[model samples]
Target: MNKVSKELKTGVLLVNLGTPDSPSVPDVRKYLREFLWDERVLDIPAVPRWLLVNAIIAPFRSPKSAKVYRELWTENGSPLKIYGLANERDLQTKLGDQYIVKLAMRYQNPSIQSKLDEFQTSGIKDLIVIPLFPHYASASTGSVYQKVMEIVSKWLVIPEIKIVNNFYDYPKFIAGFAANARKHMENFDYEHFLFSYHGIPERQITKGDCHNVCKFGTCCDNITEKNQHCYRAQCFETTRLLVKELGLKEGTYTTSFQSRLGKTPWIKPYSDDVIKEFGKKGIKSVLAFSPAFVSDCLETTIEVGDEYKELFEEYGGEKWDLVESLNDSENWVNLLEELVLENSHQK
Candidate 1:
């Protein structure tokens, strides 16, 4: 890689997790195959991962997932893709013609391979890769980073690549969430608040340097140099920031994890359990926040808003309202602009 010249155009790639092309079994199956087959995602050997994802999970899960996708679809299309594409287009206009801003899903259509293919010959000497995940996780951000490098490395001459990591602590990022949540919290009469982040396998946590510092108890309460990259710790840090930013008391909000798969235990305080307990404890009227997701997709829109809401209501809770993600919000667009300008010119 050579040093970038001042006049060189910068290519900004904003990568989201992804959604199926349509709410169809075949399309959903295809999406699942590409998503779960990743080594970073499935985290199993080649043959087993292939057999499990391709032969079993994808084939069976697609039908059920397609139904959920159908429920999640809007008049425009998949909300994740819609919001992501809008971010890309608007961000390009905000950045003007000086930079080429494009959006891609890590999994299905608009795949990273095809997107990087454009930048491969776009005459851009500098490139910025921002995985849209707020926190650093092997399955999410790490997978995006690996896939990007794998493709870009093959280019005859690679651009001066700069892949930005987690923005968990970015002020504007937190402010965006806080601003969105405040609109819902204006009433501020709810008995409790829940911060439900996407869960990862607990083994994935101890699998990395986090084993040195993370006990997944009090260790996650504070972010340290050793455990900084720990997904669990970063999740807690996000919760801490939101609590302070929103002026909520310590005991008022609880942090939990959702969307766990398989039988093995995931990061603790599972969201279902927490919601059930909130009802069992007779706590009603709760506000839920999913900071793990920046856009309203299946996880946020259906899972958190609908399914979880039903669970809470069934368990005796009166209300379970979810705070929307920062989907194409002005605050988020501002943050994206800062990310591009601040890193694109680095020494």
Candidate 2:
């Protein structure tokens, strides 16, 4: 190895699914309008897309989603923004001044373009991009990659980029999730554990089908060789790992998807429907986990925390608890440091 006088500037970029700028309806409308209308996200044509998003989806969905965001917003702001800032700070501390850590949202404020510019201006030559989606989807991780490439295309000097697609199988990542769930379980008497993740439209899933695999039934059943990159498979993989870590028995726990938009089919079983079923089945106490998201966001905080809580309670369930996301947890920060080092070595 040659020793050089210049320090190799490496950037650690943390990307999340994103949230509205505020809890207001208009802001949520803007956020969703962009998020749902993405060709990569919806995987649909433009004409029906415009009608679906603007005329029907945005008009009704925004106000309802905004109310959910209101429940999630704190005095500071969205929990996603709050925890994203904290995660960046903690990762910076763990990385020990050798790397620059920048956080951005896939949908809204502090966009990928602006963050990459900040990193480029600061002389970062090597980059580690970690999309906070624990399970990778073309719509999520691939979208981030597209945005990064789009921005870097304009820059005079392009940094070498390494993307962390999914940490679903990472030991430390699994441990952080198990530990968080265990902490909440200690206080609450929960009879069932539910893992709920953001739902991507089924059309989006098929576009990345890789082969004829991932028919969304027995197709996603096997998370092995050919279908490993499948987003649905990875979500199941996360559940299996967490279940093993927590010593959970089969049928005692289940997984589902949340936050479906428009009339099209999304990956399922849906979280809202599952909660109702639990109530009908006499499952009294339940604990919900949103492992798809590494950091607490509007989806986990409001969609799972507040909205699901109300649904569970309304249906006569006894106790419902949502596990806190890995927001600046020591294990998470250390895991991130390891991820950066591993990727840098690979380069």
Candidate 3:
């Protein structure tokens, strides 16, 4: 390994799914406009996507979504952005003066373009980017990479860029989730455990199944060379690993996908249906975990924690506890440092 040089310091960019700069309707609308317009996210043809986003989704959903974001806003700010900033500070401290760490959002304020500009001025010729999604999805990790490259290509000097695409199966990741879940489980005798991950449209998975390998079936039950990048497969693999480490009993837990939008059929079993089924079965208690997210965003905090719990209770269930995300945890900090150091070696 070459000795670290102050002039050639590595810039570490930590990215997460963005939040509205404020919880106001106009801010949420602005955030949604940028987020939904991303080709990778909407994945539909440009004309219709533009029509749908501009004419329908953005305007109608914005005010209502603003209310939801209000529920997620913390004293400091949006929990997603707040925790992302904390992660940047902690990782910078942990990595010491040799590395410069900055946080960015794929959309909205503190954007990837702005962060890269700072790195450029700082004279960082080497970069390591980490998208905070555990599972690899075109809309999330891929979007971040595409945006970064698009920005840096205009510069005369392109840094040697390395992006940690996904870390769903990293040991430290699984361990961190397991530890968080155990903390919640200590309070109640959970009758069942549920692992719910954010859902993407089925077409997105099919489109990315480049090798003709994704069967939309048990083919994704195990990770292989063929389905390595399949988002659903990677999500299931994360659950498999975390379940093993937590010593969870088979049949006592189930994995489902959540947060379907405009529904052209997303990955199933849908989390709402899962909750209804548990209610029907008269299961009174459950511990839920959102393993795909590394931070407690609107998805984890409101969707899984609040909405799901309300639905479960409505269906005759008693206790529904959501395990918090791996936001700014010591394990996560260590994992980030290790990932950066390992990538530094590759250069």
Candidate 4:
């Protein structure tokens, strides 16, 4: 009797937005140029966009942003990369010995192409690509898919691939986020819980409008099939789930967007404005959460943690606490593991 050969296996790819290789001006410039110039990111004509990015933004902003990133950088390097590696390790552990788990940055080093090559070379038959963005956006999750497909399309042998666009409303994800919030809040006194997400240019939002439903407030206030893929709507949904899970009242918590670039109108209830509002309202203690990002990066670490903290204090608020990100937390790891396993079985 001929022996049947065992199949190689399935794998999971966890992709994050990414960070610069180092917290230096040149590195930040290089990273920003690639990130900002993407048609999906900028969503503008080439000449005006080129003039804006190359002539104006990168030259001036790179130096300032690099300083912020330097503060966020650890001895090991970028916190985003460090946490991403940890997530991959913990996820592999939870998924058991049967699955091959890998992590890749959507933008910088250890890129999607190189990691996908590793999977391809390892003879993976079924692949699941999970972009770490909790909410779907063309600039974030969709960009990852584009890069993944760009690489896989070139391979002589392409594996069956599955992409999870968003888990903003997933029960496991909601539970994990709430649990983390509760864990942190247990030890502190927070008068308010703020969900601060990364911002994308408003033009990007309107262009990728799977439905013409995102008017910023009226549309995202009510999530439905029409605006299901809408970035603004999904972010609101994430906040809603967490608020429900944590039993937070309407006035007790709020959501906002951060890290907007070029100033052309990104999502609103901007973090800066929110911080000022909190301070002005005499809300002394605040706990901020970055739901858009699963792993902490410069946006969450420096932008939210440092910049917003200072802003809050400057505006008269006392004791602003930015909740630590879900960086390989046991519950979060298990949540991701289950997500992968359940999706893998579906294939």
Clashes of each: 0, 0, 0, 0
TM-scores of the candidates are 0.97, 0.92, 0.97, 0.93
> For residues 204-223, what per-residue lDDT tens digits would candidate 2 score against the true structure?
77877667777787766658
Please identify model 1 stretches exceeding 4 Å from their true place: 1-7
lDDT tens digits by residue: candidate 4, 167-239 = 8888877876777778778898688989998888787778877656767777887678788778888898888
Clashes of 2: 0
Candidate 4: how many backbone clashes?
A: 0
Reference-based lDDT, each prediction:
0.90, 0.85, 0.91, 0.83
Model 3 RMSD vs true structure: 1.5
RMSD of 1: 2.1
lDDT (10s digit) by residue, model 1, range 1-347: 34446557889999999999999999999999989989998897999999999889998999999999999899898999999999998999999877999999999889898888898778887899999999999999999889998898788898788888999889999999998888888876888999999999988998986347767799897987789899999999999998989899868899999999999879999999999999878998999999999999999989999999999999999977889899999999999999888897633
Model 4, C-alpha of 311: deviation from truth (Å): 1.1
Better of 2 and 4 by lDDT: 2
* Winning candidate number (lDDT): 3
Query: Could you give candidate 3's per-residue lDDT for residues 92-136 as a string of tens digits?
Result: 998987789999999998988899999999998699999889889
